[model samples]
Target: MQVSIVGSGYVGTTIAACFADLGHEVVNIDIDEDIVETINSGTPPIHEDGLPELVGKHAGQDGTGRLRATTDYDSIFATDATFLCLPTPQADDGSIDLSVMETGATQLGKTLEATEDWHTVVVKSTVIPGTTEDVITPILEEESEKTAGEHFGVGMNPEFLREGTAVHDFLNPDKIVLGADDDRALADMHDIFEPLVTKSDAPVVEPDTRTAEMIKYANNSFLAAKVSLINDIGNICKEYGIDAYEVADAIGLDDRISEQFLRSGVGWGGSCFGKDVAAISAAAREREYDPAMLRAAVEVNDRQPNRLLSLMDDHVDVSGERVAVLGLAFKPGTDDIRNSRAIPVIEGLQERNADIVAYDPVAAENMRERYPNISYASNPAAVLDGAAAALIVTDWEEITELDAEFDAMTTPVVIDGRRAIDRRDGIVYEGLTW
Candidate 1:
């Protein structure tokens, strides 16, 4: 099967590579000239484990003539299946700004309108319920002048990928969900993914489009809520001087709440949890329903950054103080900083008039782009130089090497946001809520 992935993001690139590895012809379309050029030269634009290797292998002469990269819309229409992996960024009002997704779909519609060949449009981006038939299909019909399932079929196949583990997750997905009203569309998608699923023994579920959409939100919301719940428990334990890690250990043994996203920390950041939870809460409110639990979960997570700030304020006066933040990205595995807590925590300190110095092993390059006012350091120790206190927001392994060095400081104060540091002594270490 020939597949065209419309967006060359983390999800899109991995999907294209994985499909190409399975002997399917995959063309990735992107507007970025640099990215398209990079991929055309048998290199991935972004970093991920096993991605560059797979992309290089399949895109190069060794594996398949199947994988290719392009910016041409004509190339996109040439495929039998077009996968929408575009971004559905959030607006300020918390509603998902489907502008990018809609624009891509509309463009695809125009292409399909002019094309003579039949094709199936699959949405691999995360979207709210009813987006497929209600929002997406209408645009396709209006632009294409043909009804869906009559001329071109449609389906919603949302991606579930972690940034660091995207390639592994794609090659060995827990499940492959296909949601389409048209049997032909579903069968086509099944054929495309059948080999990979069979090889990995992954489950292939054929749920309704709306159910499939809801599943993505439900899964992310549950994980976000669980993390928030654990953080809230950590906050409560902080008041009573109880170790949240110990408490989590006992709770995790219950089999009901196994140890995933249960770590008490400065809260979740990155692209998915924060935006998805807010968008979902907003979507629920629009439908005349209140998702109180989800709302609270978002609230707790939002407050997490400030909580770390308050913990830092406890150690020393941040006003006119030199403070070093050890990590900038939301997590250790990637350089994505869409909604990183480190941003807010740093901003919160800045509001208090602290002289900020920030460092991250890999994310510093991107963080420097996002924040120009803050001081950029060469290493963790460089950030800690002449600083009154250091905050460990992200638990990158390099930050742990400083545990002994930080302990030797004359006035060392380390605030662990993710509770990644605990046993280091001599330095004034404060774990936010733990």
Candidate 2:
């Protein structure tokens, strides 16, 4: 299969490299010349675990000529299928802003007008239900001046790749969804994922386009709710002075309540969960339904950072003190700082007049954009030195190994948001919901 992916962002770049590695000739199209050049040069434009190696092997000058990138939308005519991997950023009121997706689809349709063979345009970006049929399909049809089923097929295939382990998740998925109304479009989707399905022995889900879109939202919303529910339970356990981890471990034995997302802590903060939950909630409200439970989940997530900071305040008055914030990325393994809990933690620290020093292995430069005046240390040890108190926001692997660094703190007061660190003898350590 010859596949072309538009918008060389995180999802677009990742899938293009993976597809080429899966024995398909792939081309990545992006408006950004730097991203196209980076992909063509065999270096990934984004940082993901195991992605650089895969991109280097399949694309670029030093590897197999199976993958390449271009800035021209006309290259879509050369491929059998094109996946719209553009970003659907959230609007101010929580509705999805589809301007990017619309623009990309129009450009793709205009390019496809030159091709005579039938091509499948798969919606790979996460969207609300009815977006593929109501929003994207009409634009593609108008721009191409051709009927959808006869000239070009439309499909909705949502990606379930996590940021940290996207490559592994792609190669070994639990399920593969192929959503299409037309038979040929469904077949094209199956063909694209055939190798992954066979290798991973993953179950294939065939549903309609709307159902597919709903699945992405429902899946993420459920996970977000689950975490909030656990955090709620963890908060109760903390009131009773019970160990949340111990309770989580015992409850995980039941098949009904699995251990995944059970580590009740400072709540989830990332691109997917908050955005998807808000979008679905807004969609439901538009339909005259109030999603009370989902809104409560959001409330719980919003309050977690404050609760962690309050615990820090219980031990020491951070005003006019040096505070060390460990970790800035949402999760370990990636540099993405969007919706990271560290943002609120830093804000809370600043409100108390605390001099902040933060450290993350890869996220410092990105976080610098958000708080330009705050000091960033090259390593965790540097942040701890001369600091009065420390707050652990992200569970980076290196943070768990710190033992001697705590001794350097002026007060040695520690607050663990993610339970990433173990309690030591000298420091006054507190877990947010232990």
Candidate 1 lDDT, 292-381, residue by residue in tens: 999999999999888888877787887888888888878877788778888898788889998888998788888888788889888887
**Per-prediction TM-score:** 0.96, 0.99
**Deviation in Å, model 1, residue 381 alpha carbon:** 2.1
Report every candidate's CA lDDT.
Answer: 0.86, 0.93
Q: Give each prediction's root-mean-square deviation over alpha carbons.
A: 1.6, 0.7
Candidate 2 Cα errors over 4 Å, as ranges: none
Show the lowest summed lDDT stretch of 10 residues, model 2: 107-116
How do the residues 1-434 of candidate 2 rate in per-residue lDDT, one tens digit apiece?
99999978889988999999899999999999988898899999888999999989988889898889999988888888999999999999999999999999988888877888899999999999999999899998999898888898999999998988989988888888999979999999999999989889999999999999999999999999999999999999999999999999999989999989999999898799999999999999999999999999999999999999999999999898999999999999899999999999999999999999999999999999989999999999999999989999999989988989899999999999988888879999999888
- Lowest summed lDDT over 10 consecutive residues: which window, candidate 1? 401-410
Root-mean-square deviation of candidate 1: 1.6
